[model samples]
Target: MRKSIIAAAFASLAILPAAASGAEEPPHVDYSFAGVFGTFDPVQLQRGFQVYKEVCAACHSLKFVAFRNLGDAGGPHFTEAEVKALAAGYDVAAIDNETGEATTRKGLPSDHIPAPFPNEIAAKAANNGSAPPDLSLMAKAREGNASYIHAILTGYDHPVPEGVQVPEGGNYNPYFPGGVIAMPKPLSDGQVEYADASVPRTVDQYAKDVSAFLMWTAEPKMEVRKRVGFGAILFLGALSVLLYLSYRRVWRNVDH
Candidate 1:
């Protein structure tokens, strides 16, 4: 009995790697905000926000983001008037000062993005027992970050491989863990009409745009941070050279 149990344990352990290996790696994407000197393209970020609002908003939320962030430097960079106008369109929960009661009011720039459902239970009930995750920190939270998100969004185009049994109501996406995802194909060709006539209105473009937007949402200060880091590196490099020269000058007359 002891030998049999040990053998079973080993067999289970062996199966784990095989199951994990079944999922495909997310394909690489050359995003604008990559590498040390990378900076976000304002237009791309704007288009990405549009995709999130029109398509993903129905299911996911950006609870950590605020309307005012749209006007901030290094992001979508919408004007102050545009940000205020956008904020006014959304209804947010607020306290009625006179009555001291909870009430809904027009959103302000300070108000956080709202969830589609009131609570987790409601969200799960609406989405086939799978609550749609908030997209606020999704880029930072996931392993492959933006690439993973882009892959999942576009992965639906591939045909299901043989011997795969997708669960009920779940779509087959090889990039998704377990090869099944609850969310259906959210984008289609020409689904959204872009304001820019040059940009292609297609699923691939939408995926790329939204992925970039999420990355911005996740690390809004990334540009500032990079700039500071580079400045520090430069300062240190210059200091090192100065110190080396000083040491050489001071020790020049001394014997080793």
Candidate 2:
């Protein structure tokens, strides 16, 4: 009986890892690279802008990006005049003379973008005791950018087995910083429509586009880096070919 019990215990241990692996969730998504153009898709950027303006802007903030930057790489719908006008809409930071305190004055080239809330405490108080995280560096901050966005937007799925609960007026998402979050999934199928027929109006499509845009917001100069690398590679390849031909000519008189 003792030997039989020991054998049973060993069998259970052998199956444990496989069982755990089967129960584990899928891996996160990544969105660090660009598609075929070696640059961002203007259409996707425009769509992402629309989603940000319509859905995300009210809660989250894009403190890192300037309106003027939108005109780069042929961003759709926003012109230079419009970007300048848009950037000028808000008050930027300045020094307050009466109290000798640095405060926001109006929108300017020098000012850091303002936060939605004065502080984390204020943000949580406003949002049912849940703080809305700053999104300025979200793309860079998190791993697997695309997966992060997709999981976030679709985070409203069934609860985890760990007895995690989403309290009243709060939201739940598996991919959030904390497994339990207060912000609900903001997108759904056909929640918003797009004028561009090539771009689908589904929530997944919106999430992808917006995620791509945020990635760009995090690294606007990536295109330049990619272009430089490609150019260097081509130049090196040509040099290598020329060197090979020169070596053949020089060695011709050396005899085999």
Candidate 3:
């Protein structure tokens, strides 16, 4: 009896890992800016911004990004004139410096993007008790970066495995945690038309575009960092060469 019990326990342990591994993993994607010298693609970022504005903004918040950042160096680089126009669309709260009164104003380059809901409670009530996490840090926060984001947004609309029950109002997505998520599948073909005829207007295309955009929001200074690093390497290389020549000159005509 003791040996039989031990064998059963060992079998259970072996099966657990296999069950866990059944969860689908995010697919790998070759992002344009992924290496030491990678830079964000401006057009992809812009299309991503459009996707966020039209769809994800209804639930997710980008509170860390500023209106001016849209035009900032090494980011979306939208012209200042364009940023000004974009800011005008969102109203933000302001305090009257002298009168000590609260007021509303058009968003500025400096202003943080406003939350769609007034507070967490409102957001939870709307989304079946799970307030969608803020997207400002999502790219850096997740394990797979843009690939994970793109996978999730495009993972829905497929059939689920047999006997896997999805709770009422909950969605079944193999890529999401526990194979379930509260938010419904948010993308569909032709959901948002792209202004650039060059880019495709499909669900997968939209997912990829927005994933790139979010990566920029999470790491706005990536381009500047790459540029500075490159310059430093050049300077160090020149210095090394000079030192080597100087050593040879100092040892002129001397036998080792």
Predicted structure with the largest lDDT when compared to the true one: 1
TM-score, each model? Answer: 0.90, 0.70, 0.83
Estimate the lDDT of model 3.
Answer: 0.89
lDDT of 2 at 247: 97
For model 3, residues 1-256, the per-residue Cα lDDT tens digits are: 9999999999989887547645566888778889998888887898899999999999999999988898876777899899999998889998988898998888887888888898999999999999999999899987788888998998997798898889998998888767888989999989998987877889899999999999999999888889999999999999999999999999988998
The full ranking of all candidates by lDDT, starting with the best, is 1, 3, 2
| Model 2: lowest-lDDT 10 consecutive positions | 20-29
lDDT of each: 0.92, 0.70, 0.89
For model 2, residues 105-223, the per-residue Cα lDDT tens digits are 65653344456776778778888887777676687776565556656776576566567665788666656654666786788787777887776788777888888778777777777
- Once superposed on the true structure, which residue ranges of model 3 sit more than 4 Å away at CA? 1-23, 95-103, 249-256
- Model 1 scores what on Cα lDDT? 0.92
RMSD versus native structure for model 1: 4.9
Per-residue lDDT, model 1, residue 62, is 93
Pairs with steric clashes in candidate 3: 68-109
Displacement of residue 161 (Cα, Å) in model 1 is: 1.3
Instruction: Output the number of the TM-score-best candidate.
Output: 1
C-alpha positional error of residue 179 in candidate 3 after TM-score superposition, expressed in Å: 1.5
lDDT of 1 by residue, 199-242 (tens): 99989999999999999999999999999999999999999999
